[model samples]
Target: MSASNAQQYAETQIQQALVDGLLAEGFFDKVETEWFSAQEAESLIGQLPEYHQLVSDSAQRLWRWHYDAKAGLALVMLLRPGVTQAWEKVPGSRVLQQRQQGQALAWEALTPQRLIRAVYQGMNALTDTLDADELTAGQQVFLDALAVSEWQTASSVDHRVDTQRLLERSPAEFFAIMEQWASLLDRPYHPTAKAKEGMDEQEYRAYMAEFAQPVGLRWVAIPRERMLCGAGVAEGDQGPVAWVADEGLRQRLDAQLRERGLADSHVAIPVHPWQHQHALPKWLAEDFEAGHCVTLEVSDERWLPTSSLRSMAPVDGSAHYLKLPMAIYSLGASRYLPAVKMLNGDLSARLLHQARAKDTRLVEGLHLCDEGKWWAYMPPEATLFDEAPRHLSAMVRSYPQALLDDPSYRLIPMAALGTPLPEGGHHFFDDWLAQRGEAITAQTVSTLFGELCECFFDINLRMFRLGMLAEVHGQNAVLVWKDGRCDGLLLRDHDSLRIAVSRLEQHGMQDPCYRIKKGHSNTLYHDDLEALLFWMQTLAIQVNLSAIIDTLAGHYEIDAASLWQVMAQAIDTQIEAIPFEDEDRAMLREKLLNAPGWPYKLLIAPIIERAGGPGSMPFGKGETTNPFRQAGCAASHDRKIDTEENVAKESEALERKSLEREAQESVA
Candidate 1:
């Protein structure tokens, strides 16, 4: 990509996030006309080639934002559909200015900082609850996000990887390469998703997963009595720390421990080299001086990073994936590996294992990475929730040994499936199409997408029936491909499994005894089955599957709503096949298929509202028009007009606004 193209792409992304975040936070409801009909647009500015192209394209929509009525400053934006919000901005939009109604309209270039200021002024006029400082802080965050996005866009221009060569590699090799591709889009549609607030350019290139840079592991020796090990590792001699280190490295570690005169009482744990260089001395100075923690000189094993920057895979083809802590902030939260979270993940894994035993389908289809082996440093008076301790821990995520050894099975993270390759325009789907002797047409692509939905929803609904749901976001959910089909699902990062205690007992399962902080909210336990299903809707369907649909739609030139229709059909098929009580079936049908709106998780607004404070995963809630409704599926009950109706209403409003402005100009 050229420098100009990269800059344009980056600005487009930031603009989409700006409008989508406002819409999700109910800012659009405050404006009179938030869209422009084609007639209104052409009547005002004549028919432009780009405007016609945007309307002709099935994936794009033309929207108008009423920036300020008095200033005659309105933004004409081309947008696309988003599962979490009604519309997302597209590239090639222009801002319009007219001093009076009879005056000719002037078109100005759209920029991210300009949009950020407009949003700030709108917020200032909309609410009295927020003071100047809060609003200014929000503005600064948006600016920072824009700068970071520009950097990311410029940095990744040479990422045109070959898809055919990617398909020819071994399963493990392909998986790693896919992870590198996946790193290109972190959280799809998120504004500041790729911003590593702490790292500069050189550090970002050296440490980011997409760069595919080899990172060495730094060793730390803490007293054995103070070290906290997971249940699986505590009793075993051959655990993650042992498995990752070779005999030579182990000998070196032991010698260093003895020279420090603490060999008998201390054990060595691997640390991320960056973390050791930056975070350790800053946070562990007291411990080092008190002889409670010692840094070892031995470093070993070149490890490659996964999409999740903190996680690493051994270059020697080991299945033991290492997850370490880093001091950088992403998504408004520190990427720390606290023991409390690891313990909760262990409990969640145990429950999943129990569910697997109870359901035969899960037994055949559901797979989980073993996350039970971990180690953390705990001082004499320190608790599990301390901030410093979290930055110095590691967990070994072991893939199922059988699956790794099988040449027929390919483990691809769902993120990779959704992310379109820079060169090929599609991920493994093109490869799959070639293998199946099918042309890459709209119908064939939709058929392939339906098969994927069938496999994905099968595993998800089964777990839902068992009264639990994994956080199946794109990053955590791995689709197991066998031969040429999506065979199963493999889930990792199991800390936030949502469950209902009543539903669990009804299914002959027990609670996993999750730990929650004293005053913080308890999100793990849901009293309502609807709450549990929200995770299925938001993460599994909305985030994970919707991303893939968007990529497929763009790559194959198929309408996204057409693919969503396929999703609806697969969901209906699964709902009927899965054995559920009559009431449960009714609830699922009403909530998923018949509902006019689905729960939308607010992303950027919460960060703006947070004003750069520390928080657990930034989250807020709203509702969006159901994608099934947008796909033209019939609802069981009549609620309100669907997306098309909403568009028509906006169209009529735009016409009226235009006429009123003309009348005012005549008076002026």
Candidate 2:
């Protein structure tokens, strides 16, 4: 057979296997059949590229994410250039779909290719709104970067003898490998940063955590006045205004900024070396020339890119993490920082920190890594739609150093934990277990797994009850692991957090933002805050914790159903224990634990619908039946059965005792 035909046959086998697997796991929203026309299948086969068994499946070995067919179809058009033209080639193709039990099912093929499109389309859709008719050179560069990044990720996940060397790597190194694995699997999807010009591709991969990239950030300093700054303060500490770099880079930056009259201005912003070189020039050619943005390449600090593409941390084991807006489009939007958000970045986070601080458990267990410091240039009459100003922003985030109170406590992102080691011997969980010398058996692992679920549920519950709702999806949610145990959730990205004004009013908590912005464009919102928060947790659980549970269960032969049950119970337990309650909080509690149905963000579809820009809310929400509520029912049923069994046993024992007493009396 031709290679293409062989590829087609293999692809069908994989899809069928996945369909059967999902069926076996009963992981579907419901057991339903979808009928598809021969035409639709053909169209879909054309649209979705292949998911290879070796590399792509290797990532799925980490977690099986949700599949939305409509989102998939939409994403296919969005990812490649000439969306309309591509469809035109297949003119007869309908808005193709399948019918499951006579009900229409949107067809989403969860191929690595589709995953790539979901991310690229989601992100590029936001940027591509301004461009049309084939890819520009820069846009092509962005796309090329994504493909290469995808290749790096795909190659890395192909765990085999070749990756045996990777086992010798450190936690950071291994986790960074996971970071690359996740980069392609992003919510909006972005490939790893393309290899820098003149840099070896192999070397570039080494610099990225996914590629297990070992590299330092090149820092630059821009004048404060030259950049639009945001750090939430009613006043006081300025936060971090300077762009971050290594010690040597910092020394040089100080001298350069001072020499250039920038330090004198108290207006220097740190920049990522890649952004300064690759993205910045193309994005802000006129602005840089006009001196609206001025930078001094200071020192080179070794920083590792975390799972979140734009966020970077010190590779040299520094405590502070820098969150800079790169000009790259990853996920749904450009990873760039906008002026408005920068102005309010700190406040959004500070609001959550301060409010949650009132609750001791939350304060200790839930770390808010908000730096509140941001600096960026704002050109005169610059609107958000304009790319230059917003992309040139940087913010600093405080590492959850507090979570490190126990020397053995390590702050690992949920993504890192889910990532499989290239070599067969260990993974993130194995590493944690190794530290404590815990035996890896079903009973021990299951017990600890239950604790992990409980930790996640409670941490989210405490924060939500505190009236601080943020988008704590997989990337934002950090696992505070102590020895081999899961400690709590340490979250980053404060500006993404939303506060319920009504709930805050009840608690006498001040609103985080002075101005209210509608939609998810900013943190401040008056209405739907509770609903958004609720959905955010759902997204976090499904994407992060649930994904972890599924992976662990599948990989280790643990009962997937049992793990999910534990997660469900954890959710129920937290809702029952709301410390202080009010109407809004009560409603939130009801919806979380007992509501008939819950809403989940249909993130990719919205990006396609909006063509990637902020359409309605950049966070797309969809309704799903409340699994927690269902889990509650299941738990109740189990309890009732146990109660009945206990009653029967007692009755049987009492009857025997009475007979024995009667026999003894007769003998007397």
Candidate 3:
């Protein structure tokens, strides 16, 4: 597709995503393709007709903020369907959520505001009493989301279009096409890009793997006094720290240090170019003047950012991946990689490595991406309360050579499983299933899906039972596929590994590095037995598996309930046969399969209650009836639109506002 055609396609897809996202959030009950005449339409908001009621309904219900209503129908063009709703998985939902969606598509033309307003009309769902201050913060959150969205998919339109076109081909042809592309290039990215004003253009384009642009990492070094280092040295004769950059680069860096008469005083570190260019000038100014920090020119070797923006891999070949700190915010948390996390991430990997070494059963499909050495430099006068010197931190992580041995085997990030293919013919997994040489049948999908789900759950449970919990979101959970057949999962990223203190003790493992020493536990955040498993359970079940199930069920018309039965059976198999205690290992299985209202992390609620600064992690909690637990549930696992609940929620807000006004009047 030409750039123009790609933009057109992107506009449509982006619009579709917003509508679908809003629908999922309960903004509208249905979508209508046909537009009503101005006279025939009923009044919506401020005498706007029913045609405008879609936007009006979204706003009045607090599902949308009526920020840019001056432009009428053009507002609809800003969003595209990021993901098609599994109406099959969402009961009481009807949306004309197809290609070239939204009534705005019917419009003959749009103004320049098409991109600007669309991006500005951001989505940040609020579940709190909105005061002036709170409302301002929410708006900022929405704007930040808008800016991030704009930054993401702008340069990848052609790449996305290419993937979309190729997915329609046969499996062999698709495989060939993918081979032409970079490994891991065919990830199904959820289309959420928007054009927003005041958004800085992407500083680095190829940092996005989807772009497949070959780029080099920026390298730098700081002295020992200025830097905090966490290193894991294996049983070898090399230095204490494992460097992630090229060996040649390391040699050159060493030579440079020798030339400067600082050979023993300094060490090299890899840093995100964006951070180095933008953030470090101010943050590292003191260090540079004190002769503690020095920037080194990195030879341009191709690298690609993985699903997590902070981590990057060499495009050609490398034994270790470079994990750098980024200060940007995405997915509810600042993307900064704290030095503490970088160090602990490696230690966490070492712990897991030891576990796998002890039990060969844990070794099969599970490959621990060990992060060994991390380095960070903090500016003078920086305090604990200050945000982490994320701009100055870097870690070296082990790249699994074993998994890369077979060219036929592809390791895909779990989140990519359910996303719509770029250009659009089917979900990513559908194309994946085709590649697996499985006939595209309901039975095949269910059976294979069950296997995948079982593989994921088993790994998660087994980790918890062994006394560690890897925050098992799809980004960290990689699906290993050989010739399209689903094999076991490969887990990566160590920073989020929550170790249970008691369980680790029981397992005969103790590390002073993981303990609290001196002023506050910076690197250590141990979770109790229950909390240890919460991240795994919530992120995997609710966020990852549920998403995949929704897509497979909706897109393939496979029975969600049947899939649930498979999951239940898998859990039962683990429960009945596995040697682990019921309390720890089977906890996830019990909640998802049989318990009422499993503990769910309220992701949005915490974002709503914004506590300023580098504040402690904000998380919320709420419970919904576990769909998996329902007895005699039908063929589908669709969540019903909470009509009564929504009505009550909206009414209570209205009533509360009215009372607030009356109280203010009396005080006046």
Model 3 C-alpha RMSD to native: 13.1
Q: Write the per-residue lDDT of candidate 1 for residues 133-205, one digit (tens) a residue.
A: 2456755765676567657755654445444565567778878877787887777767677777777888887
The TM-score, computed over Cα atoms with residue i paired to residue i, of candidate 3 is 0.70
Of the two candidates 1 and 3, the one with more favorable TM-score, higher being better, is 1
RMSD from true fold, candidate 2: 13.6
What are the Cα lDDT values of the candidates? 0.75, 0.51, 0.53
- Which residues of candidate 2, in runs, are more than 4 Å off? 1-152, 155-207, 216-221, 230-247, 258-263, 266-268, 295-301, 380-386, 402-406, 421-425, 433-438, 514-530, 580-596, 613-619, 628-668
In candidate 1, the residue pairs with backbone N, CA or C atoms under 3 Å apart (3 or more residues apart, or in different chains) clash, namely: none
Which of 2 and 3 is ahead in TM-score? Answer: 3
Judging by lDDT against the true structure, name the best candidate. Answer: 1
Query: Going through the candidates in order, what is the number of backbone clashes in each?
Result: 0, 40, 11
- State the lDDT of candidate 2 residue by residue for 1-668, as single tens digits: 34444333333322322232222222333422333333434444443343111112111211122223334333221111111011111211111222233333354444433444343433344453543223444444433443444444444344222222333555444434545545433432112322222224454454444544545555444444455555432233332533344556556666876787766554556576667777788888877687656765554556677666567766655456677766544443556777666555567766776766678777667776656656666665776445667767767766655453345565666764454343323445554454657745544455667787778767776766666666666667777766567767777766566667776776667766544344535434646446556545556765566567655654455544455556666666666675745664566557655566666545333333444443123445455555554333353332122323433454455346446646976896
Which 10 consecutive residues of model 2 have the lowest summed lDDT? 80-89
Q: TM-scores for all candidates?
A: 0.90, 0.67, 0.70
